[model samples]
Target chain A: METQKTHILRRLFFSTLYLSAFTFGGGYVIVTLLKNRFVDQYHWIDEDEMLDLVAIAQSAPGAIAVNGAIVVGYKLAGLTGVAVSVLGAVIPPMAILTVVSYCYDAFSTNPYIAAMLGGMRAGVGAVITSVVYDMGKNVVRAGDPVNVVIMILSFCISYFLNVNVVFIIIAVAVFGALRSVAAQKAGERS
Target chain B: MICLRLFLSFMQIGCFCFGGGYAAMPLIEEQVVTANHWLTMNAFSDLVTIAEMTPGPIAINAATFVGTQVAGPAGAVAATCGYIFPSCLFVTLLAYVYTRFRNLSLIQQTLASLRPAVVALIAKAGIGILIAAFFVNGTFSLAAGNVSFRMILYFAAALVLLRKAKLNPILVMVLCGAAEVIFYCAGTLIR
Candidate 1:
């Protein structure tokens, strides 16, 4: 059992490090890649578990990718798992960005870097679109019209009106809590 | 003292930022750019661009860059730890409660409703990034001289490869970057 625990920690660390190093764009994109690796490849987490972790990660404060990593890590191997996972998730960004900081002036002026980034940005946009679609399909397929409505309203509020996201999250969360209470009462009555 | 302030301010940003990393942008902008004046608006924008181009969470990258700029490597570590501290603490607590109470109806219903909202936020964020990438000067300009059609083509190709071919994301990004370099080099040759 002791050896097994250490082995799990090592595996979790390396996998997360690999994921964090390669993933570009946003947290949602990393979530997708993680599903492929952890769920599909490693069997460390199943589909529904992965989905739940992601939802929690999104709703929680801080970076979704790291939040997801920590939760999944904790589930797999407890506190040690969380520590290793966070370290793995963090090291790549800190190390790479710190190096980039040293050559910041040269990087900003390089035309080749500029061109590469331009294409990558557009590609990143498209990748994000794919993530949104996959996530939306899961939500919409659950057959909740209220959820569908909230999804549309949230988009309209944020995209068109430029509302602060914190307000949107608070409003949605309040609605969710209220709906839960209402459902509880209805269930008791029935 | 500056390091202490940096850590505390980032902790505040970390606590309130929801809907994922991109959503943290405005909060980081408010704290670093407006409140602290650590970086100017132009520099912040550049930081975002660089953050996007690099791997890892944009917020983490921003924290590192801003922290490094303000103090040094130590500042970077302090700011990052401060930023992620809430997440580490809260998520661990949540995992404990959620696993135990997952079957409770109230918890179930709340998660059900929250799922769609999370999806919406992701969609909205994606569209925002897309608009930033594809639009220029508040206009949807796709002209050859203005926005690079090659980039759009690259975007379309990437989408196809990802969805149809099921290519790895890292590979897709590399291919896009390589294609852009080739295209730019060719353009220069022709000119």
Candidate 2:
């Protein structure tokens, strides 16, 4: 049992390390990648469960990538899993940035590097838009009118009005809680 | 003392960084550029570009880079630890609660409701990056001179590859970068 536990931890570490190293876009991209790996590939987690994990990650205060890693790790193992996963997630960027910081001049002024980054940013943008479409379709397919409306209003408030996301999350969560309570009470009455 | 200051400042940034890495930019700018004067605005912008270019959370990348600039390797460790500490604490507690009560209808419903909001958040972040990628100055402008057709082509091609062909995202990113480099070389040759 102990050996199996250690083996899982090791796998968790390497998976996060690989994902963190290669994921360039940011939180949502990493989250999508994580879902693909854990849910689609590893079969360690189910589709609905992954959505819940992502929602928790987004509502929390920190990088969604790290938060997703922590939660997924915890689900897989425990606190030790969290430590190993977080360490793996952090190392690559820290190491690369340290090197980049030492020789800032070379990296900043290289036109070729800039051009590549420019292209990568465009690619990252497309990847994120893909993620949005996938997740939005799932929400719409759930057949929840309230959820559909919330999704649209949340996007408008965030993209157009530029409202802080934290507020939107809190507002929707409270609305969900209140609605849940009302539903429960009605069910009890019936 | 410098390391301590870096750690504390980044700890504050970590505590307040909601949504994701991009949302943390203003808070980081406030701490690193305005309040501390550790880096000039131009350097800060450069740092952001580097952060976006690299593969990691922008907050973690920024903290490590700024910490190294202020002190050294130790400073990088300190700043990074500070930035990640809150996540460890908050996520563990939240995870425990979530796993314990997830079967409860209240929790389940709440999570269900959060799904669409989370989608919205991701959409907003994606559109922001998309605008930055396609526009000359990172804002929407229909003026022909302000749009980059090259980037739009790259974006459309990437979308097709990802959605239709179902290529690995990392592979798609590499292909786009390589294509851009070839375009750059060809343009120079034509000149």
Candidate 3:
């Protein structure tokens, strides 16, 4: 029985390590990758649970990759599992970045390197575009004038107006919470 | 003192930045722009351009550039350390709580709502980049007024080649830079 427990712990820790090494696209990409690995590859979490996990992970903060790792870890091995997984994922990226920073000044001006980076900028633009395209459906809300207005207004404010994003997030959260409460109150009245 | 402050400010950014890197922008702007006043808005804008033009991530670039400015190399180290700490801490804490209520409905709903917002943030950043890259000094200026119909065609052709083929980004960058060099050399030869 103890051996079985140890084996499970090993599998969980190794899987987390595997993800950290391979994962890309950052943030939401983690949700998709982990869902496949956890639910399909490892058989640790079921499909329904995976969906819930994605939602919860998205709602929480920090890098999505780290959040997803924590959620997946906890599902697999309780608190200890969570600790191992999160650390497993976070350590590798941080370490790699640290090493790169040390060398950046030396390479920052190489024209060949600059050319590659110029290419990366365009590629990143495409990747970011794909992300926005996926999310456009959620904000537009099927031709609902109100949502359309909110988005356009938000864009204009964000773009032309130069309004800050933090204020917008707070406003949206407050309005949403209040609306939900009011809707619940109205239901009680009826 | 400046180096210490640079490190601590980014550390605070690392700690409090909850959503994603985009979410960190406000804190970054506040610290780099408002509190420390190390970078003017124009310089901040340029730093962002340089950041986007480089690799890794925007937050990382900001930390390095701002760090270098404040206290040279040591400042860069401090800022980088400060920037990544919150994520390391938050993810660690989250690992503990992710299991018991994994099936919570409210959590799922909130995530669904948040995903769209994440998309919005990305879009906002993209628009900002487009503005910054194409719009120079608060106006549109591309390759000096030499952007003829042919130049537009070249860009369109490049876009097509990219979308229709599995071309590598590094290769595409090389091809585009080569094209620019060729164009410049041709113009010089003409003169």
Could you tell me every candidate's TM-score relative to the true structure?
A: 0.73, 0.70, 0.69
lDDT assessment of candidate 1: 0.78
Show the colliding residue pairs in model 2: none
Q: Candidate 1's error at A99, in angstroms?
A: 1.8
Candidate 3 wrong stretches, greater than 4 Å: A1-9, A126-130, A141-144, A184-190, B1-118, B135-191
Local error of candidate 3 at A122, Å? Answer: 4.3
Recovered native contacts in candidate 1, as a fraction? 0.69
For residue B89, give model 1's deviation from the true position in Å. 2.8
CAPRI tier of model 2: acceptable
TM-score of chain B taken alone, every candidate: 0.66, 0.64, 0.63
Query: Which window of ten consecutive residues has the lowest lDDT sum in model 3 chain A?
Result: A115-124
TM-score rank, highest first? Answer: 1, 2, 3
Interface RMSD to the true structure, each candidate: 3.8, 4.4, 4.8
Those runs of model 1 whose alpha carbons end farther than 4 Å from true positions after fitting are: A1-59, A68-89, B1-13, B16-58, B69-71, B95-108, B136-147
Candidate 2 per-residue lDDT, tens place, A23-56, comes to: 9878898999989999999899999999988877
Q: Quantify all predictions' global Cα lDDT against the true fold.
A: 0.78, 0.82, 0.57
Second chain TM-score for model 2: 0.64
What's every prediction's RMSD, in angstroms? 5.1, 5.6, 5.3
DockQ for model 3? 0.23
Selected candidate, larger DockQ, 2 vs 3: 2
Please give, for residues B63-147, the per-residue lDDT of candidate 2 as tens digits. Answer: 9999998999999999999888888898888778888876445666666776677677767656666777788776789987899
